[model samples]
Target: MNNKTDFKTAQQFLVDNPDIEVIEVLLIDLNGVHRGKWIPRHKLQSVFEGDMRIALTGVTPDIWGRDVPSLCAKTGDGDGICVPTVRTLKRLPWLSRPTAQMYMHLTHQGEPWGYDPRVVLGQLQQRFAERGLIAVVAPELEFMLLSSERDAEGIPQVPQTRINGRSKVGGQLYGTDIMHEFADVLHEMREACDSMDLRLDTLVKELAPGQYELNQHHLGDALQAADNAQMLKRVIKGVAQKHGYVATFMPKPFAHVDGNGFHTHISVLDENGKNIFDDGTERGSQALRHAVAGLAATMSDLMLVFAPHRNSYRRFAAGTHTPIAPTWGYENRDVALRIPVGDPQARRIEHRVAGADANPYLVLSAILAGVLYGLDNKLEATEPASGGSHEQCRELAGDWLAATRDFEESTFVSEYLGAPFHEAMCAVKHFEQDEFNRTITPFEYDAYLITS
Candidate 1:
């Protein structure tokens, strides 16, 4: 699963899958949206040979696919080479056309593009290598399956049960009966994941009517974990669409129901292959505490990476199984960082901040960076929170604007994720915020149309 790809591999793939007429070379943007070109099968060899080129701006677009004014002006909108990540090449099972897809990264003159989120994660992995540590990551992603048809007012509707075709309308947390109702779609999604070699672990009925969560088995390679998360999202959406439903990883798709979250379970291993966070006790080790402290300290600074959009803020309301403060506790689901009750040798920290909509690469990079910051500085964690009370701790940024400002001003982010990426991210977020500010929502009209 290395990032490198060669012409020989591409040729072999084309030879093996002769029916694959098209190859989708996808580049993940800052907003975690897939953007790229569909190349004829004959042209995929050129992509593997580094002959394929795309604008460097392709990886920095706003959520709407518009170029960020500051970024385009700074780079003169130059081109960068696209290098495929060999492991991601897989046939599209949900599409009618016999198509295959490969994930790619932008490079210039053989150097990794700093603005590429994958490259950022790679850089963080290199940093961990320098310290002789490996961060094992398992990500849990939550999403909703809705009817493709919207209401008359265009609001989303819960999908119908596959068995009876009745509108689904109740929270069935971990209910096997609900799971049976959507067995057809879920089974197909599982098959799709198998084809892509994604390590999907468990599927659970969530607290909302149409909401569900899928967990992935932990991977030693943090980069690949993020890759699997991204690919899994595509699988969920594609399989749902094939069944006449829409799948969304949007954090808070429905205001009243539970929001989707991307929770990451992380553990660090030393060169000797022993978990550094474990000391054969229930309390774990000092290193684990330091990691917790570092994450708590930097949680606010990286809120933009966790809650990236305006709607992303809607998921942060208190007492909704969402962590508002940078609090940590043993086996406490209500805290931002929870130390799971498991075998001491498998001890890990579960980061509960990020929404499913956040870029997996950025979420992972921010997380690993925090772990490294803790390890290097030997920071001490505050006392473990008891009984889920977090009133003593400060809350993370409540909105996108505040997060953008915090990210813009953070020296830690600039130093860790590179100054170029920090600047580019801030500029793109600012542009999006400006766009959001210019629009008046229907709620605004309903509240103030005649009052003023």
Candidate 2:
């Protein structure tokens, strides 16, 4: 519960919108799942100054919401205090009644929660601050919009275009026609974005049918940038549902089409407010090279952070836009680390490794950690990966199990994410892997039932 002194934003928001019927408090878990409770308007005032208790295991649950006994669950299955961040307060325009939502941060013993992803990122940010530097970041998130109706097999299908009221039949990358076709829903999305304070900048029609990308405005506060990404995802999903469509951020929603990606664009700034990655050259400054080297060195070890789930690994198939190797290049989309063609003052590294399904907090933390490591060690990168990176660079873990194993064995992960989070995350992933392995798939039935 928030206390009166700390609930200024909430109080003002209520005063500004007297008709609000409910307030939803949210806390994001390790898997990027938002968990919370809805309170009536009358009860909102009491929660502001009070601590809202939630089960600690709620933040560590697997995709199926099963308990991983090894992860904080065995410690009496306790509760953690969820404190709200007032700046995250926003109204849900899609809801029938006016409803407001705010994000929360978990804590224990009056200290920042060790297992919280936001806390981990904040810890890393402090490290940068000590070095008189700040990390500026923006995220490009891709997702697919499907019709709410399912086929006979209960499989999802792309929603029909608003203009033609028919399914899109072909790839239309950057097609203005596709944008116009979804104008009604997109217009609602834009309006909602404004109401929510999510700095959504651009929407592009992607290569696959029903696939699109949304880019957020860059901000020097990495955590706020991540918050924007998370909120934007919620806004898109909710608005789509209200428009009679299903929106998905799953990395590989369709096996035959392009997958969703969460590309993070990052630039470093010195205390003097100058872009550290820019030294008046197109090749970038020495700091930029160091950052790239750090990212490459940790690519394999941090694969789990970039692609967390079994479905996430499916997006990395060759010939896809997904990256196959830990390589960097300027104005090249074929490499994992791309220096986009932009103004010298805006020079930045675009990390294209993370899937849209990845946790924005963890993804940014891993990327920043690598950058810091490279700067500290003054590491050097290999020659730029031109045309393609596969032949010249080492690949990230190829499978989900392999990725988790690499993450479990990484000293760097332990160093940056803290030993407890490392252990808890590994335990959770191992549990999820075991559960997945035990389930029989349709492919298995098709192949083995007839032959064996």
Give the per-residue lDDT digits (tens) of candidate 1, residues 91-194: 88889989999999999878999999999999999999998999999999999998899999888988666533564456678888878878899999999999
Query: How large is the C-alpha RMSD of every model relative to the true structure?
Result: 2.2, 1.9
* Cα lDDT tens digits for candidate 2, 389-449: 4454347888899999899999999897777678778988998999988999888999999
TM-score leader: 1
> Relative to the unseen true structure, what is the C-alpha lDDT of residue 266 in candidate 1, on a scale of 0 to 100?
98
For every model shown, the clashing-pair count is 0, 9
Task: Work out how many backbone clashes candidate 1 has.
Answer: 0
- Against the reference, the lDDT scores of all candidates come to 0.90, 0.86
Off by over 4 Å in 1: 1-5, 160-169, 389-394
